[model samples]
Target chain A: MTEFIPPATRWHTLPSPFAMKRGGELRDARMAYETWGTLNAARDNAVLIVTGLSPDAHAASNEGNPEPGWWDAMVGPGKPIDTDRWFVICVNSLGSCKGSTGPASVNPATGTRYGLAFPELSVEDGANAAFEVVKSLGVDTLACLVGNSMGGMVALAYLLLHPDSARAHINISGSARALPFSIAIRSLQREAIRLDPNWNHGDYDDDTQYPEAGMRMARKLGVITYRSALEWDGRFGRVRLDSDRREDEEPFGLEFEVESYLEGHARRFVRHFDPNCYLYLSRSMDWFDLAEYGDGDVEAGLRRIRVDRALAIGVKTDILFPLQQQEEVADGLRAAGADTEFLPLPSPQGHDAFLVDIARFGPAVRNFLSSL
Target chain B: MTEFIPPATRWHTLPSPFAMKRGGELRDARMAYETWGTLNAARDNAVLIVTGLSPDAHAASNEGNPEPGWWDAMVGPGKPIDTDRWFVICVNSLGSCKGSTGPASVNPATGTRYGLAFPELSVEDGANAAFEVVKSLGVDTLACLVGNSMGGMVALAYLLLHPDSARAHINISGSARALPFSIAIRSLQREAIRLDPNWNHGDYDDDTQYPEAGMRMARKLGVITYRSALEWDGRFGRVRLDSDRREDEEPFGLEFEVESYLEGHARRFVRHFDPNCYLYLSRSMDWFDLAEYGDGDVEAGLRRIRVDRALAIGVKTDILFPLQQQEEVADGLRAAGADTEFLPLPSPQGHDAFLVDIARFGPAVRNFLSSL
Candidate 1:
């Protein structure tokens, strides 16, 4: 409905007539980012952190924003990234609504929300935007590039497009291309949003006309896939909600705890995220294919990227960006002559494990950074 | 939507004021069924079939209906559960709209569609209705009972509530109770239907007011889960739809072949099945747990079922009613002193494997019936 910018977020302006990957251009577009710790005099100690969809640049609390961030546990001082030792820069993706120039941003020419008029966004576009931000920071090279989920795709695009930008890479639960299953899931989610009468071809206002129901359904479907069924079975089982929690008048209302959990999780998310921005980012993922860089060969595309070392981490239980994709990334990096390690953790949390299961992910990341 | 009855379907009126499982009663309600082969003088060469959520009574083509049925591959003369030897009967579940008295059927008192006025249905009620049909056919004891997906749950209820009504049981891709993951999927499907403005609290007419969009979404969701990701990966891969197949005008429209597949599948299903009936039956599934019969022990409740022999078959890739649930059924049947077999097939099709992979399922059913 509207942009949601974190207080800690800072901005970096891009060159005028910022070109988009697929076509069209945005004028006076800016990238949103937040940094933790100081940049070393050499500038080589800076690590760029790219984010998954739905996260702002606030990876951890800072002086400007004391609130905890989505990845606070994995990026703070004495943490996996260890901001005390390395300055970490996290940027909101280009097509996102988190203070980044996106569909929610006012059009420079029309002075209205870009909405459907926004250019078809691509992961490569986000990667290029982040590269601009990194260039503006006067960082010729970085210690490591970190990316999780959709961010992993962006990072890959970054490395492929800009050579030797980072010494090493850490990819968490990402894929080389969009698989059929993931495409279907994302397609259905977009359909849910568009099918909503309130969505109104991306013209709905933030108030009564917002597509709350569509957004709720889309988020619920996402939450269902983000975690493993094993976790749901163990945590909620067949537990029914209390009578007070139940909607008694409606026959097919909230009958189970899992349903209620999804309802609450979705309700909190719908208003905070712009529907148009979500559609763009999600469609971008479906369109991402490393093969485009390799003339219809994904492996050949991976071979084009050069890095000193790479580590691909994934959870065994993740059904969306599964463990095999992690192995693919590791193998591809190895083919590119980069010393690579693929770590498949046995976390039951699925695709979101890297964000929450810090105990398992922390050490691997720390050891890799220490080696760097 | 109006009830869709095949010409071959025959009806058996339940006793007036027939009681329901959770409460309430149906007046002059009827069960729809189709049968083949002749009953022997002994009246023991009979096999009864209960079905999944969508299918009607026409499980296989017969003299009265030459049209192929849903399980046409597995249930004809000289086939699995061969009608040449054992008289075969398939009944549409009580709450279904396929020639069965359900929400789509007329309420005798008001002479209008029952809609939400229909009482809450359960697996046990379906079981009882099928049992009534079997008794009315003068079968003292069924030679065997075959159930697939939701039917498996109904068959188990039949055996538990009416001991010795069936001598043997075949439970295919079914669970003793509703798992949290399954419940969440069904809950979302119901929500999609109810959230549609055209659904009109189940009062919408079948003409212009039909909740087509809601039903399409629900069916698409169902189709996504019915098969495995492994199958999707192998079948569709990341193939894009042809330019002609793509809905180019809509930004978030169909792009991938998988999305097109889902669209066609959902479009074919939405109008055929009644929205209210889908809601009632889906919620019934979420409410199905054998633990109710054992004071909160699903295993103990499953143990209450008694039969001469039992076969529980499931596919390795079935995420909905997973392989573990089939094992649970076998374990419980064995605990109840029935000679039980658990067969987990390596079908790529997942939960719907039983309906399509007849080459594998056929021999198993045939051998099990040969033993009976």
Candidate 2:
């Protein structure tokens, strides 16, 4: 069945235009994506991979680059995703700072950075953009759509809006709607960025730093919430960072091991990610409500997802989206008369389980894909 | 046996030099405290109450002010504390700025605010100051000592340092040492305050507003931690605040109900609380290690506690100090051969359960006091 295959890495400009869900339009909107393996003649072997808040088009390592992908352990030659057998396409999400058209992109309307002028982005818009990229690559009906965290929500948006587009779906640690606790945590992150005097309402000059302090605080908070306290309790405990720092020297640098851990990730993220893009994407996640699509009914919302097969993977310790949310996905898919599998994996990683729990999550994903 | 009731609101400066645990001494060391009811002729009926991080000497509505105190519901004349029978004394801790000498206090040596130059403070120093206040009030021994959260940690310090100073001890939602999760949270809070450009390394002008924005962010984080996410989920889940606020307006203000709730408390706290004191007290809590007192053994530390009886009350939903920490206290106390009662109660509130869950926590305190 192997036939037309897109280039390893390429861009797809929307055939028509991207009509944003919340009243906006993106003309000449282009989606950046990468492909592995071959698309069958019938285009039925294509597997779409959507990423979480901070990832890009890179998912698994390929011949072009030997460096491992973000999900290299889960999506490689003999990996759970099995690029050898399945054609995989991972798209950098719209409104992202990756090599995609986002707020960082020059606005065709003004020829300058969109800055705060970027239109309101929604999960549906991201899905539509990704769909356009997949269609341009000659993939008709997707063999499987696998998304984790924010990616899971985008997959749902795609499935609900275009009921028969994907053959199967795998949602990992995602919710039908963002929870209040998650929303509050995100609001604080946004506030941290905005409160920085340098942010200037997301209109900072090109010469100066772009609210790095606020971004650092945001990333620090995100790191704390993404992983469970139990994981950190045993790992870092009350251990000091530097034993030879001479404690009596006014103490300004990182003191505890956990602080150093958080700062490391935060500093790295603040350097690469854009603050305006972060604000836009975070609000879009909050604005997502599948129940709204079902006319104020949850069961009806689930019933709209008309996939042939689906898998909902939930982590017991995932505070962002608990097991109940995954259960809702299973219940919803079943209500839509779709064959579904709900896998509940317990791990100390919390919402981050999908990112690194290869042992527990990998086998299940492989089994699901093989069965499909 | 009732006689000689201490003044309702008063200050007591130790006649002799007061020593701190780590080093140095306060030449004019003074403690501010409030009391209710009469002391017995034998001074055996005196009850001491230690406060959490932000509370002051005012525990209930007293003679000086008829208004309700922070714990007015639990410590009234005929309330659970039963001021009618036992002499109740609430002392502001050593590192607190509320009616106590803290970083905001003037250093006699420099004739300026202590600021970062304040001597290193530990839980033991706070306990020593509180004990001195009680001793100066003509009290030979306390009938009981009640503490919650940070206060609970201080109570353990006092009990271990002066074995026979109190007949009974009640520790609510506290641990022998600050856990990693708690330490991480406090670290972020201190970082928030310090990162604020207006903060000037704890040397900000006294005339200007003191890093209120940073303090607000820190307090908001504290409020989130002090209660369970499950509690917020049911109460303020994804609901928009002030529908009147236009959707297109710049969102510098609160948008979610949880944000409003947190911002309200944070704003109130930033006005009254000193940022430097918060930093000092928070670090002091993280530095508290009971094992240090016991020559590096938890059981040996508990064995140093010479109290006749003790009670540890823990809320099941408390994430800051989970049930395991309270269990550790009970286990250690029993290992030390002290008569101890361990009660694990369920509440939606997390660490703040002790402050507001009077219905659940009140009867236990009253019963424990009556039995003692």
Candidate 3:
């Protein structure tokens, strides 16, 4: 059996809400988080790196068998985030399969896994959970809150809900509101999970076979949007899969390097991710809306923010979160009397540029953090 | 039933070798073509507009229903092609269902549909067929041969096979070789058709099902690549299919504009196209490679071309056939001593720009044809 090392961190419990926006209620809610570096006497050097849809507190730190964190390149000792300079904190939000109290967590009332009984999590609720994590960390104010994709949504929510909580915010490859096309793609991914016969209506236990097929399908669909078409074509136009073909046989097959890349991504993702979590998180992303909380006046809502600075970074080829959306975020922040910087990075990686195009992104982020 | 009207002019058949590279023999193969406008006494006023993968002889002249032809904008009485001065001919190439001997055509010996017995066609075969059509039109030489996508591949083939056939050639949004990603996508589409329960190993003629599910899936996949993510996100993001929902109950969900758009496209295509035909055409496209025929010397093959001039047009957002491919075509033609013009049309519609972005494409094509 593999040895399990408990996280060298503390967990924080949040006030239970009866019902969430999408229905269902929580009896006892909690969040998992980890902190790095040290808090200054004024507690002003805190930097919160919010986790994506399924990520946990181990965002900027190493985990299991000396493997580096997802954002290690941007966060480590002398890197962009610079753990040596700032007290970096990451939290596992509600409705996640990590150490947080999610569908996989045991329910106090039922004495069983919450499963589908877990309350649906909105971006605001996720932010609220993170807020509790921050308070527990003994931090009164944060220097910056940096997030990517769904985490960006959470960061935006934090800026809206607790204006004085952070001095700066970085929203990377995220939008103010989910677009209709995104909703459609997310819906399909959710349906792929829900429709899987092996899902057993989300009742499968840890020991049971997970919805691998559904997860694989969802990952495949996600991969399509995560990269640019030019990247796909340039990397792998109509190429043969196998070189040895029987005489008189048609050799036309998925021979392209892009197809193999996409397939590998799907296969690897399915191995670690839960199908139910995929559906829940995708739906939450689709429903995320900053204007909704601000009564539909996006500018007015942003004006209510009390942050000191904002940084919006967009990838040029990211169709999911276009550069225009980032410009809107910067415009909103500037209008709110907050100093804002909008950087559009050129990359062929599309929406996943933040994760893959480290060469270009690392220095920009480092400069931004240093300026802050 | 749809009304069928014969062309005002008579058709002449030109002889071609029926034997394909795949070892199948199509005995007594002939190419049928229609010519519009009068040929000059010297017969040097000939122009050829190669139709797309499925289009037939009716490329640009008015037809029975008084509908302008497929390329009516650039080839009318007083338009760019100038029917008053130049003779234009369009042919139905081999391995197509448009008045051509495709899988659906009856075999002379068996008195039945050729079906899977149809020979696997190559880009060279398509060019050879076009050569026959040009010869049958009684044109000793062509002033120009214009083609798009698959048709562009044929034009390249023509340049390699019959170096002195045309003075100029236009290859729009096409590549000298099929990219690996394109082949993989085509393979998946073919697999969708082949795996359908109703496919009956490509022999389900009597079954009325006609692989609708498989075809619908294939079309959905095709539509995703046919357009760009930017276009889809800008047009359809996450809009719901239904605006009204019953109280206290979730309505049958059909959310997201992209899904609805793809579904509509899939449904409409299924009504007209055969699943088997889709498979055959996709495979043909996947296998197309000018380098394979020119002994893998693309530059040398292009240098052998005797065309006096060439025009290559590429759409900015055409991921399937990007602007770089068109640039390569122009460079090749220029290297061969042909006066070449490379025009990159700006559009967000991706590969479908040629069909939809008429405002931009029309003027460019008009200018080129007028100059010719």
For every prediction, compared with the true complex, DockQ reads 0.82, 0.58, 0.29
Point out the worst 10-residue segment of candidate 3 chain A by lDDT.
A1-10
What is each candidate's fraction of native interface contacts (fnat)? 0.72, 0.54, 0.38
lDDT by candidate, in order shown: 0.91, 0.82, 0.71
What is candidate 2's lDDT per residue for A1-372, written digit by digit as tens? 011122345778875467888887887767878888888787899999988887878787777656677888998888899988899999988888776778777778787878877788898899888888888887778999998889988999988888678999999988788777788778888899989988888787653757888888889888888888778878887777677742346544467788788888987887588888888888878877788888976668878888989899998877777788899988999889889989899888889988888999999999999998
RMSD of each: 1.1, 4.5, 4.9
> Where does model 2 exceed 4 Å of error?
A1-9, A245-252, B1-8, B207-209, B245-248, B251-253
Q: Report the lDDT tens digits of candidate 1 across residue range A309-362.
A: 999999988988988888988999999999999998999999999888888998
lDDT of 3 by residue, B1-372 (tens): 011223542344435346676577776555556677888889898988776665566766564324566666767687766788778887776676555566666767798777777778777777877787778667778988878887888888887888689887878787676765456556556655664567666676644757765666667666776777667666765445564531114221345556667768877876466555556667777677766655776666666677887888998877667678788888888998998999987788887777677788777777777787
Model 2 per-residue lDDT at B306: 77
Q: Report the lDDT of model 1 for residue A282.
A: 97
Q: What digit string (tens of lDDT, one per residue) describes model 1 on residues B1-372?
A: 778999998999998899998999999999999999989999999999999999999998999999999999888889987889989999999999999899999999999989999999999999998999999999979999999999999998999999889889999999899988888888888888988899999999987899988888899989988998889989998888899988899778888999999999998898799999999899888888999998999989988888989999999989899899999999999998999999999999999999888889999999999987
TM-score for the first chain of model 3? 0.90
Best by DockQ: 1
By lDDT, who's the top model here?
1
- The candidate maximizing TM-score is 1
When sorted by DockQ, best at the front, the candidate numbers are 1, 2, 3
Candidate 2: count the clashes: 0
What lDDT score goes with residue B71 in model 2?
Answer: 91
- Model 1 earns a TM-score of 0.99
